[model samples]
Target: MAGTKTIDADVAIVGCGVAGLYCALNLPHALRVVLLAKTTVDECDSMLAQGGICVLHDPDDYESFFEDTLRAGHYENRLESVDMMIRASRPIIDDLIKRGVRFARTATGELDYTREGAHSRPRIVYHEDITGEEITTHLLACVRELPNATVFENTCMTDILEGFDADGRRVCRGIVAEDAGGAHLQVNADATVLATGGVGGLYKHSTNYPCLTGDGCRVAAEHGVLLEHMDFVQIHPTTLWTQKPGRSFLISESARGEGAILLNDAHERFCDELQPRDVVSGNILREMRREGAEHVWLSFERVPREELEHHFTHICEQCREEGYDIFSEPIPVVPAQHYFMGGIHVNSDSETTLPHLFAAGETCCNGVHGRNRLASNSLLEGLVFAQRAADKIMRDRFAADTAAQLAVAASERSRFVAGSRDVTDVALLCGAE
Candidate 1:
């Protein structure tokens, strides 16, 4: 093992995806931040998200938007979280624009909107098919230019360090992280945030980076943090079926939104293409079972050829590489583990049950996505909650006097060094939360 190193910051953010990057960007510039990535910053699942992010197009669309989200979640969602995410949509979009992230726009200069599964209206903002990449890349660029922010790639947070506060409440001091070179790092901070993506690594097949194994949720659980909705996992209805043994390529729901159709062995439409993820996945599974088919076929023939080339170029090229011309024929697809709707239970401000610890993105169940996530809402939910976490931390935690901050950090560091522990056992691992 390499020698261990220690560092201090006002905040320590785990994961460098959209949620982590957005949280770091929204933090007060006066406070220093240390952002950690498990691998290269661009290797996150957020960059692989092809579908767009949902937006509340107008005030009048609020009710329908809420209903759509709840319907997709099977009415198990927390209303307040849903409300907060929807209301915060416009401001988040505006902030992204200010940070130089551009979404698709029409010839007349209006924001281009698209529809996806389970949504009642076309309120998604995208940049072709790589919306997540577009937004996350912009956030990464913005974070790189911040004087108060420092990003460390190839740093995996192995465990969250917990210490007792003055009031005897157990709180998170920071984390023990390991880098690719085998150097162990002790990061102590006034606040700690986990934006560590999802549980893709635990699945046989997924539409996520294979490295994401719900590390944040697992660490939180080991520390006795309260988790929620441990059983609710969302399997995407359409992933390009390659019999290969690795991460599956996702055929974004936006294809169906733009007129793709699902067919079984008999080439018959077996289910509503626009249903929520769980519903669609269940329907496909049933069809596969009933027809004795290994995979279902997804046809994009009905979509306009020009739109296919322009909006779904990545998917088209990938399919062609697999020896299937998506424009001419249907491609094989199957349900695969996509997103987790359950995780470390967090409050409205993205605070976990543990004091001084917060979680956002797929790592935490803030309840915006209850039983299932609506199509294209994952990216928006992630950024919205991440910004909220930063907002709360900066305003209430790190905005204190410098003396107080220093004292807190000193105390936490002393306690952490005395304990000196690393997470080696992952017995707390679960199927979902």
Candidate 2:
């Protein structure tokens, strides 16, 4: 790190996705926090999420939702994590609503829910298809209005500095970052949280934004943090294909739930629409290889054109602009990189193995989503874990004690070394928090 100016904060959070934003919003007002984002807040993958959050709103729906999630993960998920998520589902939605997020409502004035593959019931709460956008937009606004939170945009964290203190226990002291203007700065805090989103940009074709380059995983690994199941990348089953390579667009699964049919070049239904994403993507890949075709077709003719236009107006317009009438013609699609099922492993509380480091959202694998994630579960995971982390922080009061010690130590050290400064002052240099 180049710039040596020092600033104090109770906590420093990296990445401004839903988890980061929610955590900042829920943290105590007395605890000053610095929230860093590699790009603008809205540019994160959370905004691109067209699907909603999955929750067991009805008491009767819990068992079926749990079973569907376990089956989607191929039964490899940790049971405790699944139960925690299931229990947190409704509360998470209620919390978001309290934060002013407007979820889709039914004609009867009830919360509107939708069904996706592997789900047993319509339990997804959304704002039409742009649910993530609505939630993130509102939460971001709330975080900005908080006096104790400071947001840093276009700032990229290079690495986390970890070391052992007097007690010989591991600790994360601070972070080295490069701002948008290319100036390197070191930020130290009492605690650091990593909420960097997924690793979708690792693939050539992805529905994620360009900034998601596995930075969190790589940074955690460099600091000797343990990672799990890093190879289980989730490829979305339906993505709009362009003649150009590596620019596929997401065609949300809601389209299929609305009655679109996946067909091969020969006009044959190739795979089960209700299968898990991994299975569906695999089937689509096999059909493409067997039929010797570049892409498959998704036909929405069985659904009314007006209804399709009303719910999926953006997709319909894009399809029309791409020279295909979604109502009358088949829209070309293929499997594209979507979500990362594996990440820095954490427990139900969203705490990582590293001390003073917490993680949530797509960056951390909390095991609620084991081998695969059920549709609309991503947003719920973020909301649930963000709240869990906030509750843990408040209960533990780690910020207050650490910040006090750090501030006192800095004040005393400055007095001790005031008149005995040397050209090379490594002792005066403090690590990032």
Candidate 3:
């Protein structure tokens, strides 16, 4: 305990993916910010995102976009959150462009928009196929350059320390984390944000990084925080089927958006490919069951060869490495757990039930996605809400400062040894360690 390191900040952001980085960038430069990356910055699930973020095509398109998201979510989505995300799309995109994140453009210099399933129009703005990497790498670079921001890699947040204010209201004080060397680090902050990714690691097959085992949700649950729709997990309709075990390669839904089609063993087109993900996943599973096959075939022969090479180079190379050619043949594909639509429930401001604690991205269920998520909307929801969270944090800085005043209420806060606390300690209380 004597060797434990302690750091303090105006804000502590857990996770270094798109949501976390974006939130940090939006915070005021005067605030001392500390960002924790469970592993290396490159290992976040956001880097593995293949599809582009969604944008508003027109004022008239808002209703359609809203409907697409609600329909996919089975109408259970929070209307206000949906409206907020849709309205905030363009501004977020503008910020990204201003920050030097590039999206594909046409010869006329207009942004290149692609269509994913369930969308009525072309609203997805991408950079070839590696949109996520382009966006996150730029954000990470920007984060590194910020004088007030500090990033810690290989740090695992083991618990959210809780203490009561003078009024006896339970509030968050800080977090306990372990570095790569297993040394304990106590991070105290005025505001704590949880942008940790989803529960993909819990599945046998997922498109998410293995380290993302719903750590945020598990931690929130231990603290008695309200979580919504934990059972609502989204299974992507197309991940490349392979005999080897590990992270499954996602065959981006954009491929189907570009004119590829799914086929049964008889090579017959079954359901419409542009339906919501649940419908498509159900159809695929039904087809597999009826045909007694492990996977269905997705053919891209009709898609333009030049476009395939230009837009999906990474996918093409990966398939080629596996002895398949996207330009000439169909690839074996199946559904796998892709996203969690439920997590620590938050308000429009992204503040959780716990005082001074907020969550964003896939780690928080603001009810934007409702029952399921529309394709390409995940990134938009994250950026929009994360920005909102930062705005709220800055607006109520006085409240956070008051909460920060209570940091030393519990003298044993940093005295608990790393991974040595029992049921009586905050670590066990938060279901970590």
User: Per-residue lDDT of 1-433 in model 2, one digit per residue for the tens?
Assistant: 3455455777788989899998888899998889999988888988888867888978988889889999999998888888888998888888888889998787898998777787877888777667888999999999999999999899999988676755688987767788888887677876778899998777788999878988988999987888989987899999998876655678888777767889999899977887889998999999999989988999998777756866677788778888988878899998999998899977777888887678889999888888988898898888788878877777657655787799898887776667555635535354323
Which candidate, 1 or 3, would have the higher lDDT against the true structure? 3
TM-score of each predicted structure versus truth: 0.91, 0.90, 0.92
Give per-residue lDDT, candidate 3, residue 289.
Answer: 99
Clashing pairs in 1: none
RMSD after CA superposition, every candidate: 11.3, 8.4, 11.0
RMSD of 3: 11.0
State how far residue 191 of model 1 sits from its true place (Å).
0.1
lDDT per residue for candidate 1 within 1-433, as digits (tens), equals 2477988888999999999999998898888899999999999988998989999999999999999999999899999999999999999898888888888899999999999999998999899899899998988999999999999999999999988876787889999999998889988898999999999999998888989999999999999999999888899999999977889999999999999999988889988999998999999999999888889999988999988999999999999999999988999999999999999999999999998999999999999988999998899999999999999997766445676888987787666655655332222221223
Over 1-433, each residue of candidate 3 has an lDDT whose tens digit, in order, gives: 4788999898999999999999999999999999999999999988988979999988999999999999999999999999999999999999999999999999999998999999999999999888899999999999999999999999999999888876899998878899999999998987899999999999999999999998899999999999999998999999999998999999998999999899999999999999999999999999999999999999997789988988899999999998998878899999999999999999999999998899999999999998999999998998999999999989889665667665753334555544444656765644686
Clash count, one per candidate: 0, 7, 0
Error of 2 at 429 (Å): 42
Instruction: At residue 121, give the lDDT of candidate 2.
Output: 74
Candidate 1, lDDT over the whole model: 0.91
Task: State how far residue 236 of model 1 sits from its true place (Å).
Answer: 0.2
Off by over 4 Å in 1: 402-433
